[model samples]
Every structure is written in structure tokens, then in C-alpha cells.
Target: MTPTHETPTTPPPSGPVASAEDVELLAALGYEQRFDRKVSLWGNFALGFVYLSPLVGVLSLFAVGLSTAGGPSVFWIVLIGLGQLLVALVFGEIVSQFPLAGGLYQWARRLWNGRYAWFTAWTYICCITIGITSTALFSSDFVASLFGGTAQHPGVASTPLQRLLIAVAVTAVCLVCNSFGTRVLALISKIGLAAELIGIVLVGLYLLLFQRRNPVSIFFHGSSASHPGSYFAAFVAASLVGLFLYYGFEACGEIAEEVPNPARSIPKAMQLTVVVGGLAALLAFAGYALAAPDLEAVLTGSDTNPIPAILQSSVGTVGTKLILLVALTSFIAGVMSQQAAASRIVFSFARDEMFPGARIFSRVTSRYRVPRNALLAVNVAPLLIFVFVYFSPDSLVRIAAFQVLAGYAAFQMVVLAALRMRLKGWRPAGAWSLGRYGFAVNVAALVYGVLAMILLAAPTGDPNASFADRWIALIGFLVVSAVGLVYLLTAKPDRKSTAPEGDALEIAQRLRDRAASAASAERSEA
Candidate 1:
């Protein structure tokens, strides 16, 4: 049965009343059906990796490696990794209970009530939309890198018009890919994950077998002058970047309505995705650190294409080509994944009349069973933002990064709030349970997230830092805050839906049965 067909008594308790417009919007978006439960827990986990695009993490690592004020410290990297794990635990708890496409926005509405929820959701939409621009910009840079030089190279057409054109092309391609359907996107993500894994392994093997270096010592002893003064600061900053790397894993929960046995599969997928992706990132960082030549040069290089430089120095010409290919594949895959997640978020918003063009944007294609128009809307907005950034030239990369980090920070806040409410006797029924530790985990993540936001806003010691860094962070926050204000002024409080006592009991029983079945299956397999 479709999600729409299945009567879920667990709706928001206090929000805008469901008017005809809301019902029409939901119906138009294919909300009448739940997703087919064909996705197993493992498949959902794999899908998360595909959604995250491991290649993006590698690229971010390279960027962090080259940053004037960051990198050269494995301690920072490790700290960031832990921070993300904390944040993911918080998200896992909220999403497992309320697995829906609206993501943080939806959770915020249900937990916070009235305008606060609207503002939170609106901020989330804005952040994700900005993130779409960031992904497009990155994909364009990767494409430009293929032409004999880096995107930053003067010879490689750094002109505003050229960059804008590239961004548009990449965004258009992403839109087309996402318009097909979720299953196709999932398949593509799976293929991308495989390629990314192979590429990492290949690079690691070359570094290990040929470069006769002590991996342990390299990890333990190296220091970069560019890294910040305190391990605490480095940890905070690196965690911000690492959190970005792990951003898209929640896509599984966003599409929970479409998945079979979503309450179970979604949470399982989220956990596995983080664990697997985190391990892969750890290995990749270790290999890159061990294989790097002149750590100072790689860290200090002005070029954005530092990964190629590292591979060329360590593995020769053939290795550089392989690394480039891996980068191209990973980048394109990342763009595709971003498009899918962004579309779903927008569709969810439209279903509740949070956006303009609610009629068109929420409509699902009859043939495709996807929100085709909403996908188009999501893709187009970011493409325009990319163009704006590209033409501004000076502000593109930093602005993109600022927007993404800000959005992520906001989402983290919503998750923290939801967990807090749940702890205060507001629990939702689901297959996954945080047990007694949910509150502690949520608090840790909130603390870490707030610190990371502050660090991101602070200026690096480098004199040549872009204005984009400072202004983008400031403006992004203001924009979200402004939206929040509007929500407070215009939104109305309404009754929230709670699971009927009977339905809640039934759900609990079903969850118990499913757990028992899963345990039995595991034992049998063992």
C-alpha cells in the first residue's frame, strides 16, 4: 500500500490546519502511495553511500589539506570525524521515528509547532538550495580541470561567463538524471559508490606497495604549519568539513515514504551508511597522508586540483590520469545525488504550501511516479545561484562553502530540538530506539554543531582570504533568520496529529515482531 493509502495517525500536533489546498498539494505529489518495500536494510545503506558521493569527501579533504589555516593535523580530521558521528546519531534518532521527505524541516514543524517550524523548514530549504549551487560549482570545476589545467588556472578560462555556462550545463544534466525516478538514481549512486571504492583502493595500494614509507609514522608524526594553533580549534573546523562530507546520507530517510518497511529500513540504512562511509574516509585520508609529497607544497599550493598534484608526485603520469578520472566520476555522481535530495526536500515543502508554484512544483508525473516539476524547480534555482556566484568571480567557492555549512548547521539544530522534545515525553513510535542515550547524544551534537558554526564564521589568519568567506556566512545566517521572522508573523498554530492509541499499540507490536524476525534471520545466516 502507498503511504497515502496507509492511514498514519502520527501527524503534526499543532500546525496549519490541512486545508483543501494542502490536501490537493499532497495528492498532486503522489502522496497517495507509500514507496515499495523492496529496499532491504543493506540496499538502503548502500543507497546512502551513493547519495553522499564519497568522491566529494575526497575533494573536501583535498581542499582542507590545501587550506591555509587548516589541515596538516590528523588530530583535527579525527575530531571532525567524531563530531559527525555524534550529529549522525542525533539525526538517526529523529529520522528513524519520522522518516519523511521534508527532512529537518518536517521534523522541526512537528516538534517546535507553528511559525517556528515553518521558519526552520524554510531555512532548511534555503540551505539545501544553496548547497545545490555549491555542488554545481564543484562539478563545473572538476569538468574544467580535465582540460589540461586546474579550474583556478588562468589558462583554463576563469572568466565569469565561462564559469556560469559550465555551472548551467552541470545543473541541467543533474536535473535530467533526477527526473527519471528514484530507482534509477539509486542505481546510479550504487555504481558511483563502487567506482569511488575502487578508486580509493587503487590509490591506497599504489601509495602502500610502491611508496616505501612507514604509514604509522606518517600518520603520527606529520605537522602542517598552516594548521591552526589548538587541536581543539582544528577539531572544530575539520568537523565542520567532515560533517559536510557526510551530509547526504539522510536522503534515505527523505524518501522513506517510497521505501518498503521504511521505519525499519530507513534507520538501518542511516547507521550503516555512516559507519561504512566513515571507515572509507578514514582509509582514504590515511593513504593520502602517507603518499603525499612535500606536505607543505600540497597544503600551500594555490591550485584547487591538489589531488592530481599529489598523485603525479607519488605515482607518476598514469596515476594522475586515474585520479582525475576518479574525481570526474565522483563529482558527477555527487551532483546527481544532490539533485535527487534537493528535489525531494522541495517536493515535501510544496506538498505543504511552503513554496511558490505549489500547484506545479508539487505535481508528480503520472508516468514516472516522481515530482518532475519540483525536481525542475529545485535544479533551476541553484543553477541561477551558481551563475550569480560565477559572475561575481571573487566570491564563488567561499560563498558556496558558507551556504552549505550554514544550512547543515541549521539542520543539526532542528535535529537537536526534536531529540529534546522526544526526551520530554514526546516520543514517536518507530523500529529504532535511542534508548536512554538519545538526550546525551543530541546535546553533544548540538554543542559541537554550534561551535563549528562559530569557527566557520571566524576569519583565517591568511590576509588574502576572499570576502565571500565573511559576507557569505553573515548573509546566509541573516537570510535564514529573516525567514524565521516571517514565519513568526504569518504562521498560525493548529492542532497536531497524534497516533491514535490503538494505532500506536499496533505499531509497537509490529516493531517487536520485526525485531524478532530480524534476530532470527541473523542467527540463521550466521
Candidate 2:
């Protein structure tokens, strides 16, 4: 009476056939295993690690954090990390029960309803579709720094053409890696993981040990930027640094079909990703902070991009350039992992035949055992975003800000659904679960998610900023949500979905109905 909508389908058409247990489990949930289970626990961890990419996060956001929050800005990492750890725990429980590919969409659908799931995916797609382009553009400068094709303007921005070409190239390379096979995706993740560890551990240690230019107390008191009247205000303004870094861990479960025993392994992988990623980011941030020759310059508006300066002054030019290469590698790996996550969401949505052109995007190439068309689909979408952002570089910065806001919005939808299910008496039945602590953890994650969203959406910190500039994140959220609403109403895609909604709640109701009917029959016989 669990509403086991058993999908009596042919054998898995792509990838190696799943083990009987895996196959049966997926079938019970209304899907057949279609991806090779090539990822081990470690490989899954690597995917999340590379996607989180401590080096990329710290290098990119350190200056903003430093300038706004001064030395005390470093603690945003700790605060946001702890908050995000709670989120990971909640996700751990959810993914344990529903380790389906497409991660957010799959989890949301089962916990809530099909309509809710469709919107979650729509908002999420908008986020990652632009996220890839922005991330690629961010790493373009590092790419140019090494390759020497970009003309320097001595503190001005790089040419739009330079950034566009390099970003496209980055997208192209990752597309190849992702389209080939699951094994190749895991390998790139592992390689990126190694390089990131060295960037964080080796470089961080050397910077902290050999290039220590400031006292440890710098982080406690902050700098001139946070001096006197500006202490609390400045710290609050720099919250994006931490908010941006703690995400990307969710990418771990997006390829649940490619992972073995994903229910157990993915939850562990997700939690490990948050814990290790947090520590690595803190290490890298502290190293750069203490090693900076002039902390005040970094904390003030003078040193806009302090990472390269700190590296150059602390290490020689050659070492700094080498680290840049490492950063570029991390960015590429991040793109690869992110693209995999995004494409799988499209595949999951399409397989239900609830999306436009579902047949095409859902196609899996037998040779690679991957959604080749979906992979191409995600890439092509980003190119359109690239074209849109090219004319107005300022919009590109706002796009970066909005990406995190959109992702957190989608994340909260899942959290809200899970909390609702728990209230309705559903318990997680997976290889991993929180047992008695599930409710408490779920509530806490919801609180954190809500507060985080408020922080992200509120237009504060910069008094000189215009309403549009300050409210960009909120504006972006509304625009994306509006578009999704229009689509949901117009297309009515949820009507076509075959996956069970309200998950166990629906199953429990069916059981109750069957019990009542049997009791009536017995009484009539008597």
C-alpha cells in the first residue's frame, strides 16, 4: 500500500545495468536506472569538493570581505560555514531517502508536489545557467594572465572579447569532459580536488608560516575600515563572501545515478563536502590575510584585488603565476561539476515528459552512458547568457550576486517541504537518517535558510548604491520566479508528471483507505 508505482520498463538502455537491489529500488520510485554507477564515496566527495572549490571562492571573495568587514570579515567564513553545515545535514537526510539524479528537483518533488518541484527546477535552472557563464568569466582573467593574449589596461577591466572567448573555451573543454563518460567526470573532479588541496594546504601553509606579516589579533579587531563607527555595519555588508562559498556542495547528489549506494554515500559525501570545504576556505582566507603586506590597504578600497598582490609579495612572481594556474584549473573543474549537475536536472525533468523538447534533452548516448543532448543543452543556454551580459559589464556583476540568491531560494523550497513532511508523520527510510534528531535538524536548517535568504535579498550595507543596485538580488529572484509562474500556468507541465508527489504522505493515505475497506468487508461477511 506504499503506492509502489513500479515502472515495468525494459532494462537500462544506457550505462551498465544496475545491480538488482539498485534497479528494484529505482523502479519502486518510478524510474529505471539509466546511468553507470561509477562513483565511489571518495569520488562523490571529490565532485562536491571541486565544485565548492575553496581556492576559487577565497581568491575571488577575500577582497570584498576584507574591504567591507575589515580583518573581522574573515569570521564570515565561520558564521556562514556553520549555518551552511546545518543545511548540509538537512540535505543529508533528504538525499538519503531520495538519492535520485537532478538532486534539488528530485528531492523537492517527493517531499512536496509536482507543481512545487517544477518551479524549484525552473528557478534552479535559471541560477546555474547563468552561474556557469559568470564563473567562467571570473576565471577568464586568470586564464589570460597565463596565456598572454589579453591586452593590459593597467587596473582597468579586460576586453569583453578576451573574457568571452576564454569563458567559451572553458565551457567547451568542460563540455567534452562531461560528454565523454561518468568516469571522466570523476577523474577531473579528483584532479581538481588534488590541485585545490595543494592550493589550500601547501600554499596556505607557506603563506601563513613564512609570509606572516600581521599579528593573529588582526582578525579579532578588524582594520581601519571597521574602525570606530563602522564595526557592525561593515561586517554585515560583506556577507556575500561566505554565502557564495558555502554552496556548490549540493552538486554532490545531482548525479545520484552515477553513484553506487547513493542513499548512504551521497549523504556522507555532502556532509564531508561542507565540513572539509569550510576548513579549507578558512585556511586559505587566513593565509592570504596574514600574509598581506598592508592589511589596511586590503581592508580599505585601495587594494581592490588583494589576492594576487598578497601572493606576489609573499611568494615570488613565478609562484604567484603558478597559483593562478591552479586557480584556473579549479575554475574549470568547478564548471565541469556544475554542468553535470545542471544537465542532470534537465534530464530528470525531461524523462517525466513534463518539459518542452523533453525527448531531445532526455536522450542518453549509449556509448558514453550520459545525457549528451542535455549536456549540450546546458552549454548552449549559457552561451545565450554570455551574449546577454556582454553589452553591460555591470549587469554581469549583478548576475553573479543574483546566482547565489536564486540557488538559496530553491534550497529553501526543499527545506520547507521536508519540514512539512516531517510534521505529517513521515520518517526517512534510507540507508542514512537522523533518527530522533531529524525534526530538530530540519527546523534549524529552515531557520538558517530563511535568515540567509533575508540577508541575501535585503538591500543594505552600501548607502551610496541605488535601489536597483542594492535590490538586484531580490529583483533577480522575483524575475526568475515570475517567469517560472508564467511557464507553470501556461504549459501545465505538472499534469504530465508520473513521479509520485507528496511521497510517503500519499502512500500512508492509501494504506489507511485500504484498511477501512477491508474492515467493512469483514463485517458484512459476519
Candidate 3:
């Protein structure tokens, strides 16, 4: 017979070589996956609302009260808002270009080296896991408040065991909701966000139009016991606290992989969320500043229940009830959003073989196409941490706060890495580029992020705090990271295969041929 086309009998490449090709194929497949762009956009925006609640803005006002206990000054609080805006812009720039599911971790990897990327992702996972726990604790506190019980009650707040039980219950409910699917989460978020906005608007309007208070002068100019030092220091401290209100825009970046046209959509969604959110926060702060009763009383009240005190003082029983109800909705929305983002982050890490039990964690459920295993991991890990809260209630709040702050710090560091890339002429093409202003915006964000971390770490005028209480948060973070470090060091890289590479090249060629053929057909018809 004429020379027959002999099929290659050689074996395919194995191990690392085979693995690399699989990864490339997976990436290409991801490019073909589609999501409803509008639903994705609104889902993201609603998620943003769930992320930033009017109640948190109210909490920021309490921070203002704490900072200015010696006097009244809204200037500093407003400046804090400005600082957050700058940071938001920097985040917008980076996430716009690289809207992947791994978020800051992926950004760190692409901008810096692979080794550092593992640590960044690890820190992010810990921060978010702890954050979910903290949100659950806060949700428990809010639920308990609805029943006229303070978080510090002997049965609830006084004993770590009691608090942990409450935390477990709340965590269970949130985990269930998250496991249901994104559509359910999105629906809950929309309802929760609407209730929160209405409550804030009603409360603010009542404060502004119905209640009569001291002239604006008191808010702009006054002094009290907590403000014994320089006004600047007080304002700076308050700004740090206020910045917490602007903390969750990065939630958008975490879900980027699920969004259609993510590179364009993520940046726009983020920018809109922050700008709109900042304005809303500003309005709420104005309402509080204008209607504040006794600044000292507001600051010194049980930190857990400051809003109740303010509402009771300003608008009587009815207003306080309304505020409580709205605050509950806000917390619920927050829990839902936290679970969604945290689960996605965990899933992304697992998909990359960065997490233990990756095969299970990375598997998407055939029923819902959701990462059920990852969701379970996200939910269970925190419940275990909540168990510790049962034994150490005093440390729970601080631990949660520290974990969230650490995550933010890690995110900021990655943004700084991207900024360095820009300096090195590694310009990425994208619809959401910062253009000429990227450098300045990133610098401001980095400075603000670093300063906030320092202030948060420093003692809050409290001495004699036990080591277990103060350092437990950092210890938890370090432990999680240590585990990730060991995994990254020992895990073998997956190999690539030439067959898959050849297959990809052939597929690409077929696509090009089809396009060319279509163009020729159209010309003939014309």
C-alpha cells in the first residue's frame, strides 16, 4: 500500500507537562462560558449594597463620637470619607484590569512572583473566614438585641459558651442560605438592601425634619472628655473607624469570574458602589452629627448598642424600634454577602490546587454548577472557630475585627504590587485602566491602608489587656498562613502535554478558518 499515515504509537507526556496543557485548556474553556450580563451586574450591585449597610455608616458615626468625646467636629469624619474614596479608586483600577475569581491573590501572582502569590491568597482566605465568623457574631448580637438582650448578658454575652452557641446557630442559618444557590442569595440581598435603605432614609429624614436640636455650630465646634489630646489625633482616629464603612467593595472583585465581560463590568460596578455608598454614608453622618444628643453618653454607652441609644434619644421608642429592625436586616444582608464571597474565594484557591483536599473543594456541583464542597468548607471552618468563642467571648469581637483588617491589609499590599508593575512599564490593556492617574491614586491608597493597620493594631486606650485576648487574632492568622506555606512549598507543579497543546492549536486554527470562510461567503453574497 502507498505510504500509510502511521498513527504515533509513542506515549503522551505525563505529570507536570500534561498538567500544564490541562490548565491552558481549562482557561480557554472558561473564556467560552457565559453568564447573563444584566443579572450578573445587578447581582453584583445588590451584593455591594449588602456589603455596605447604612448601619455600618451609623457605627462610623459612633466612632466619630468616640474620637470627639471632648468636642464636636464633623470635618475630620468627612476627611476620613475622602481617604476611603481614594482607596476605592485604586481598587477600582486594579480589579478592572484583572477581574478573576481569586481576586487579590490572583492579582498578587500576576503582578509579583508566584511564591508571594500563595501567601497573599492564604492571608485573604483567613481574613475572609474570620470575617464570616465575626459577621455571625455580630448577627447574633443584633438578634439578641431585638429581644431586648444585650450581647453582654450573663447568659449570652457574659459567658463565651453562650455566645458561641448563638454564633453557631446564626452561622448555620447563613450557611444554609448560601448553600441554596446564587439566585436565592441575590434575592435575599435585594430585599435586605431595600429595607436597609428605606430604614436609613426614614431615620435620617425624621432626624433632620422632625427633631429640633442645637444649631450646626455644636457639631462643627465643641469639645468633650474623650478629646483630651489634639483635635487632629481625634479626627484621625475617627477616620480610621469611619473607614470601616467603606470596607467591602472588593466583594465585587471576588465574583469577577462569574460575571460576564468582567474586565469592564467589575470596575464600573465597583466605582458605582463606592461613589454611591460614600454619598449615602456622608448623608447619614450629617443626620447623626446634626441630631446627636449628648456626645459623651453616645460614646460611653455599651459599644454593642450605641445605635439604640442614639435613636432613643433623637426619635423616641418608635424610631428606636425601626432602627433596630433595619439594623437586623443590614446584618443579615452582610452575613449573606460574606458567605458568598468567602465561598468563592475558597473555591478559587482549591481550583488552583492551592488548598488541601483540592479535588473535592474544586468540584462544582452538577445540580447547581456551584462549588458545594468549597461552600461547606467556608461554613464549617468558621463554626469551628466559633467554638473557641464559646470559651473566650472577650476575644471574639477583636479577633473578628483583626481578621477583617488583616484581609484588607493583604488586599492593599497586592494593589501596591500592581502599582509597582505600572512603574516597571508592564501596562495591561483593559477598559478600566486608571490611565495617567493610577500612580498617585495607588500611593494614597497604600498610605491610608498602612496607617489604618497601624492604628487598628495599637491599643485603643486600654491597658492590662490579656495576651490571649489581644494576640489571639494575630495567632489565628499566622497559623492558617503557616499551613498554606507548607502546602505551597511541598506541592508538585502539574506537568503539560504536547498532545493537548497540539489539540489547542488545531482548535484555534479551525476557529480562524471558519471566520475566514464566513467573511468570504458574505463578500460573495454582496
Candidate 4:
């Protein structure tokens, strides 16, 4: 078959897109700069915000939190924001040093070695692909509710077949948009950000002004559910609401090569994403909590979808549909942003010839300057994951959330490793280093990451909590990491023809020398 969107034969435009210093920095880091550097600072911020898509997360998981704890669980959003701020800061520092396509994967590769880097890429690639399925399912649910009557239960009128079809349709649209490259992707992101902001402000104002309950103090109350230990267990389970809200900001750094002055711009973009997304989530969640006409009944009711229930009560049918329409648009934008970022991860690995299908996946289309093959591959995995959505929506969302958090944990561990290397005198040369505050910030990030990972993997006290879903995330991450280890030991991609060139290889060689010298010095002391 003829190539879809014929591959560009000419080299990328070579005008003054990036300064000579930028090219030198990238070369030193072990990669050729190939993408158009047209994304402005605001565009970069939009990319991160669009990926995080707080509106989508809050709407989808608001019920999960309400049912998990109670009104007070909404407060967990603030705590998660503080913790994720640390992660974002560490990310900012690292991405500044190595502002490349792979983001965390590239950072890990430089911090340690190829084997460690490969696994980082592997885990994240799997997580986001599953995440696409999750996004699609949530989008479909909202779409179904928007079209179906107010009296219908969330899923009553929408059959499994209909849900899956909507999901596939949404995913397909995202894939086509992604194939058009960053210009089009950026346009979608900007529009989505505007719609999402409008939705949050409009919905929050409507709820607070017109529909809010009088007893605002109820926001602090815990859930009525009984935990075997303490109610704190319920609190921990409820915190997943906030935990889920804070990711996808790192997508800012994932396409560093495509942004102008990436070293400086990527860091600020990440920080803005955290701050803005956190605020939007607070507005959305608090609005939902304060607006609910009957909190106890909504939490304990047969229809556990707090968002729609609350919206229906607050704004009635017409207004609820309008807001859901905005949410639906934001959800589509989210899928597009996610696919775009995930494709970069694939393209980064393939460009280095480390992945299994490197030659095919690394191809960037000449016409659009996008990774067509990798985008296609990225889009296909979600359809496969849709199999789970088709058969087991509840179980799959829980499990997929688990898997995605595991991926987040893996990235945090890599960040900690980078800190260790920094402690060992591996200085960062990026424009946006943390300076005197590096050690403190890195420690905070690591601590927060470890705690969040454990809490996310812990069993919930919710009545719907399952034994299997509780353990699946941690156990699955271990299995995937082990498989990556086995692949490294047997296949040894590091020793093959695909070894990275430029600054990364040079740095790896120096690290080995430093290790050998340190060992010899210890022997002499003995």
C-alpha cells in the first residue's frame, strides 16, 4: 500500500528555529534535532494542560472519591497538588538538562544505562496506551449520558455495544488528528483548554451561586464506610481522586525537541501545568461536592455517578447537557494530546533502534513531519485495550488506573536515580537547574512519590473494592520490569549496533570510568 500521507523526502526546515546553542546542546545529549521547533511557550503549556485535562479526570473520578470517602475526600486534591509540585520541579530540572523527545525515558538513559532506560520507556508506553482506553470509556459514558434522557440511569440506555462503539469512534478521531502533526495537535489543545476552562468556571459558578447546599461544613466529613482498621484507610483510598488528577503534566517535556528554546521553556511549561491544573481540579471537585442536593443519597444511591447526578440537580437537564458537551470536547482533546505524547515515546525509542520494531516505528512522515507508524501503533494498542472496556468497564478502569500509577511510580524512581547521580557529581548543564535547592527538592519528590505509590496500590475501604484489583498494579509493574530485565540480560541491546551516540554515550563511558576509579581507591584505602 502507498504510504499514508507520503513520507517527507526533504530534510526538516533549517531556518533560525533554534539557536546554534540549542543544536549543540541536543547533539551533546546524544540525538539529532529533527522536528520543527514552532511550539511557543503558551503552546507548550497548553500541551501539558491538555494532557492532564483536569476536567476529564475530575468528572470521571469525582464519584470514585465521593463513594471512596465522602465530601472531605475532595480536599485531598490540595494535598496531591503539593506533592505533585515536587515531582514537577524535579521533572523541570531534568528535562532542562536533556530536553529530548522521550522525556523521562531519555533522562533515565542518561542517568543510568540503556537497560534501565528501556524499561522506563516500556512501562510508560504500556501505561498511557491503557490510559487511552480509560479516556475513551469515560468519554463514551459522558456522551451516552448527554444523549440519553435525564431519567435513564447512566448506563441504562447505553448498551455495552454502544459504549464500545463510541469509544472506538473517539479513539479513531484522535488518531487521525494526531497524524496531522503538531500544528493541528496544538490547535486542538488550545481549543480544548478554552472549552475546559469555560466549563469549570461556568459549572462552578452555577453550582456555587444557584445550587449549593447551605451546610458547607460537611465538606470536612469522612465517609460512612467501615474499614477494618481505621477510617484513615478510607481517607487513603479517597486520595486516589487527587492522585489521579495530577499526572500528564510531564507530557510537556516529552516533546522537547519540537519546542523552541526547550531547555528554558519546557520547565516553565511543566510548572504552569501543575499550578493551573491543580486549581481547575479544586474548582471542579469542590463545585460538585457543594452543589449536590442530597450528599448522603448521591453517595449511597444506585446511580453512583456523582458528576451527572450533581449537575442534574444543580442545573437541570439542558444545562447539564451543555456542560457535558464541553466535557466531551475536552475528552477528545485529551485523547489527541495523549496519543501525540505517547507517539513521541515510541518514536524516541525507535529512533535509537532500541525497540523491537524500530525501523518501522521510527519513520516520520515527510508531508506532516509526524511519526505516522508510531502514531498508528500507539492508536492500535488502545483498541486492543478496548477489549477490556467492552467486557469489564468497572474492573478495567480500576486496573488501568493501577497500571498508570505504577508507571508514575517508575518515573519517580528514575527521578530519584537522577538525584543520586547528581549527588555523585553529575552536574546538570541545562538553563533551568534547581541550583542550591536541588537536593531538597529531589528528596521531597522521592518521598512524595514513594508515599503516593504505596497509597494508590493499597486496598480501598469502598464496598465495591476488589481484592484482585487492589494488588494488580504493583504486581503487574513488577512482572513487566522483570521481563525487561530478562530481555536486557539475554538480548543486550546496549552492546548491539544500536548503542546511542553523541553526549549520552560519552557520559556513559565517563560514569564507568568514575566507578572503576572509585573501586580502586577503596581497595587502596583497605
Output the number of the lDDT-best candidate: 2
What TM-score quantifies how close candidate 3 is to the native fold?
0.79
- Candidate 2 clashing pairs? none
Clashes of each: 13, 0, 20, 2
Model 4 misplaced regions, further than 4 Å: 1-21, 151-157, 226-229, 462-466, 497-526
Estimate, for each residue in 1-526, the C-alpha lDDT of model 1 and write its tens digit. Answer: 1135223333233422333432432333234442233345655665677656656666655556434333444444456667767777777766655566766665665566534556666666666677667766665555555555532331133356666877777677767876777667676667677777876766766676676343465444334344545544443444444545666677676666556556556776777667677667666666765666555555555544566556666766665666666766666666776676667777766666666666577666644557887777767677667667755776655665566566666667676666557555654446566778877777788887777676666654344666645456666677667766765565532223221111223333454565698799999999
lDDT (C-alpha, whole model) for all candidates: 0.60, 0.82, 0.61, 0.77
Give the better candidate number (2 or 4) by lDDT.
Answer: 2
lDDT of 3 by residue, 325-399 (tens): 777677777777777787777776666556678668766654344567887887777888787777766666567
Is 1 or 3 the stronger prediction by TM-score? 1
TM-score of each: 0.80, 0.92, 0.79, 0.89
Q: Which stretches of candidate 3 lie above 4 Å from their native place?
A: 1-38, 60-77, 149-162, 212-215, 221-233, 292-294, 300-304, 313-319, 463-526
- lDDT tens digits by residue: candidate 2, 420-519: 9989898776668788998998899889889999888978566678999989989988988988899899989999877677775654354345558878
How much is the lDDT of residue 187 in candidate 2? Answer: 92
What would the TM-score be for candidate 4 when compared with the true structure?
0.89
Q: Where does candidate 2 have its weakest 10-residue lDDT segment? A: 148-157
- Alpha-carbon error at 136 in model 1, in Å? 2.0
Of 3 and 4, which scores higher on lDDT?
4
